[model samples]
Target chain A: MELAAERHGDMLLVRVAEPRIDAAIAIQFKEAMRELVADGAPRVVLDLAPVGFLDSSGLGAVVAVRKSIGPDRRLELAALTPAVARVFRLTRMDSIFTIHPATPGPEPTANRQAAPAAEASLPDGADEA
Target chain B: MKPEPVLAKRPAGAPRHPPDDPAAAGRAGAAGRGHGTTALQASRAPALQAPHCPDAGGRVPQTCSGTLRITLPATETGVRRGLAQVFAALRQGVLAGAVARDAAQGQAGAAEPVPQVPQSACDRIELVLAEALNNIVEHAFGPEPPAPATESRGVTAPGLIALDLSAGAAQLHCTIRDAGRPMPDGQAPAGRPQDIDAAADLPEGGFGWFLIRRLTLDLCYVREPGCNRLSFVIPLSAEDPPRPHGL
Candidate 1:
């Protein structure tokens, strides 16, 4: 459950340093994320580049974090490894979040619109706000 | 970061051959004796075996395989260790088969490469195992059942989950047995996750069975008098071209 949080402008980037997010650490992850985003920025970008595996519980934890953040704020995902991306794709969760190819640097606004294919992959009304 | 090693290395001089007794072997073997048996069981009666095909050297490699069986209490810690140990056994079996294949080709002198299981296959297996095992610990055992309650009192002592894994050249077979409540209507759940547009109605659970059904082949669930057995086969990837014999 190694997670690092940093503030980059209005967005808070939380990177999961572990390679796996399974039942073993799913609850811990959700609690950690809740604490990180408790009094932080509205926009969040979860960097999952280092995470090579994510099970259903891990996927559910991510969804739980998003729901905790509320709909007014956005919970975007960035730098999903192929294995992690496949889980999201198979579960159809790719439709729910704005996913980026990598962690966005300084110019966050441009990165949001960088991956249009991801945007196109989202379900209806997911792109709102 | 690379995924943490789920399987540990076997101790030096550990027994290579499976136990002699058929009942012991079936209980400990990767493949179990059952009505709905997989191809591995049909071709190799005892345990998973490397193919006997002769290599370019015209020598058939001796089949080498092993089975591990352990019944653990249906606790979170127990489930975690059970999954890790079984998965590790599966990995070892696959690697051993690959080594045998390489030896048949007379490439034993070449640096023994660290056998690599395909990442996609590994991911699918991990995901399915996690969901299934967690479901058992959480639902089947009813969170934390009181210790020492007699079965006659309708309170079973630390439910037991037994895992059997067998790895063949073309596929890996897994069988999990548990004495827990049967699924609703005595049928395994099916279908995809619910289609949700509103965040309020989004589901946090109920995705376990769906993923298990989708990722596995020949998936079957049967309820015996007092136990539930779930078995599935995961096909190995054929992307890697056959290694040139004696290369």
Candidate 2:
């Protein structure tokens, strides 16, 4: 549940520093998202570049976070790794969220489902949230 | 955190493998394993009786790929480790299956199909397994286990899961057994798809069985006298590229 949030202009970009968001930590992830979104950003983009696996519990947690943030606010997903992207696609959640290309990575993979990685260029500037 | 005891040692004759031994985990040569293969014949869990397997006495056709049997405590951490070990063994199967297929075709060509488990397939398997294992770990064994050996009718006691996973070139077969409570009506639930159209109050919990049903084939559930058994086969394809969207 190590989520680092950065304000990219009007949007908030939260990078999931964890490789997995499974049943083991789905609650923590939802709680962390709740706290991050407390800043009242209109749009929040979850950087899922590092998450290689996401189970049903993890998927539920993401949905729970969205509901907790209120319907007016948008919770977009960015740079879902191959595995995470597949989970979203299989569960049909991909259709629900507004997905965007990842920031950038040193060397990107050929998997067309996911965008490139982002941790390589994190501006660890103080947490605006 | 108290020291976990080696409470139930499986019978020496069981074909089970230690999850700690990664290299030895895959080669579960259960070809000649006699009648008891289907049942959890272990003396561990003294109160629980032996679970019955349908193919108990019948000769199991030889599975050329890796076969791994793991007896894991029904807990989140235990299921996580079990999934990891099974995933690793599956990778081994994929590699072996690919090489066997390649050599059988009489082509000593360069590495073709990425030589690893398909990314798309791995994701599905991981998600389905995570859902199933987490379901069993959390619900099947009831609430947090009562103090170790105290077994009452309320299901306050946690149980163990014996998992048999085999990865072949064509399909991956899994058989899971536990001493916990059986499915409510002696059958697995029909996990229906959630209506995402419900803008705000979408369901979160019931999606697991839907994913399991969506991803698996030949799914079957049975409640033996003292145990619950579930077996399913997930077909695989080496050359299946990722689908653009859900089917």
In model 1, the clashing pairs are none
Native interface contacts kept by each candidate, as a fraction: 0.32, 0.50
Q: Per-residue lDDT tens digits of candidate 2, residues B44-146?
A: 2212112322244434434422445555567665666566645544433422443345434545574333333444455566677778877887778765832
Clashing pairs in 2: none
lDDT of 2: 0.60
lDDT of 1 by residue, A33-59 (tens): 999998658899997765656777888
lDDT of 1 by residue, B86-159 (tens): 54354344334433344335555775443445544555666677678778777777857333222222212336
Question: Positional deviation of A27 in candidate 1, in angstroms?
Answer: 2.2
- TM-scores of all predicted structures: 0.67, 0.70
Per-structure clash totals for the candidates: 0, 0
